[model samples]
Target: MFAGVDIGGTTTQVLLCTADLAVIDSTEVSTPAREGGQAMVRAALDALSVLRARVPSRLLGIGIGAAGVVDSRAGRILVASDSFRSWAGFEVTATVEKALGVPAFLDNDVNAFLRGEAAKGAVVDEPYVLGMTLGTGVGGALRLNGELLDGPHGAAGEVGHIPGFGDLPCTCGGRGHLETLASGRSIRARYGERTGRLLTARGVAEAAADGDPDALAVYEAAGAGVARAILITAGLLDITTVVVGGGVSRAWDLIQPPMLAELTAGPPVSGHPIRVVRARLGSGAVAIGAASRARTELDAVTRV
Candidate 1:
């Protein structure tokens, strides 16, 4: 058996998987976001303990999909949001391995998401693909030739941070980034800007569904932003298969038309049009992807 943990801003999920990658048991717990990195690690460990108690199994190792800029080789956080106190520079993998007495592997959450999708979810069997998660923040990942592409800087597929959005402030303190217009937070902010109504992203989507022109316009802008992001990625890597998910994606009905419009507005690149689709794995993608990362690493060690 193997263990997988996905540590998010609000919750932490732990799952147990069979050798064949079947998730047999799972548990979730509220994340201790303000308590610092050590507390966050403890939360993951607690979730793992819960999973083990539910189903007795010998875990070969643990894999973690954590939010932040991760140095996967070091198995630690290189940079992170202020959401988690002292999260940056925390030695996650070493600590987890020491506490659990088992091997552990860590990766950026979005990278893990793509890994799971490529392994068994939406983009299964694809050789090259791009993935985005449009929730609290926009995240991106790339898979090249069936492998997760974490470049030397560990920021290979961060399309959300790419520039070209025209001077709007982004969550990362940057201006004119894609996240300014496409992230879930941005959608809510955009609606508030138009009507002075404070509503969640879901609420804005609901308003759009009810034919609110302002809400519809917000989603349309987001759709255009996503389309431009895809085109930029396609132009650089020539990988046009995109799998998107997260809370914001639930508003696909509102965004797809504009997104598709922008995608085809320009001539096809290399005679290949973009093919974008929704992620099928839902919230479980990160955990499953983390587990797959652990499995892949184990296989690599065995061969060595």
Candidate 2:
């Protein structure tokens, strides 16, 4: 059996599936932030230990999907949560392997999402795909052929930090980044700027769906910003499909038109229309992708 853990700030979900990626057991627990990554890691291991004790099978290893700039090549965290201090560049995979005595694999959450989509969801039919997550910030990853493209520093496909649009503040302490203008927080904050209403991203989407012109305009701006990213990425990577996931994608009607418009206005493709598609696996994508990574790594280790 193998384990997959997606450790988010709100809730942590774990899955103990078969060797073939079929889920055999699962559990989720509220994350405890007081202890930071240490506590969260312990919680995940505890869950896996409980499962190992229950199941009558050999435990292979664990896979982790983290929500930060994870450096998978080094199995370390380059940058973690903004709300907490820092565990910058800490070798997480080695630590987890040492603690559990099982091989472990770590990956950025959006990278995992891309892997999941490529395997079973949006990009199942394609040989290459891009996955973008639009929640707290606009996160992205790319998969080529069947492999996740982790850059030399394991920071590939971070389109959120790309520049070209109007200047806006980003969580990474930079201005003019893509996420600053197109992310969920930025959308709601922008709406608050115009209407003086402190609404959530969901509320803003609801207002847009209700035909509020201001809300619609907000979505238009977001779409334009996101389209800038797509245009730049297409020119750089030449991928045919872009799969958008996360909470903001729920407002696809609001964001897609402008995103598509900007993308289409750019230099034409070679008769292949650029596709901005929705992620079908949704929340499960991250965990499933992480598990797939675990399986791959385990197989590699066995071969070695």
CA RMSD of each candidate after superposition: 1.0, 2.0
What Cα-based lDDT does every candidate model obtain?
0.90, 0.82
lDDT of 2 by residue, 70-98 (tens): 88877778887574434566677887999
- Number of the predicted model whose lDDT against the real structure is largest: 1
Could you tell me every candidate's TM-score relative to the true structure? 0.98, 0.92
Tens digits of per-residue lDDT for model 1 on 224-290?
9999899888888888599998789989898789999999897447779878999998898999999
Clashes of each: 0, 0
Q: Which ten residues in a row have the lowest lDDT in candidate 2?
A: 81-90
Candidate 2: misplaced stretches above 4 Å?
50-56, 267-271
* TM-score of predicted structure 2: 0.92
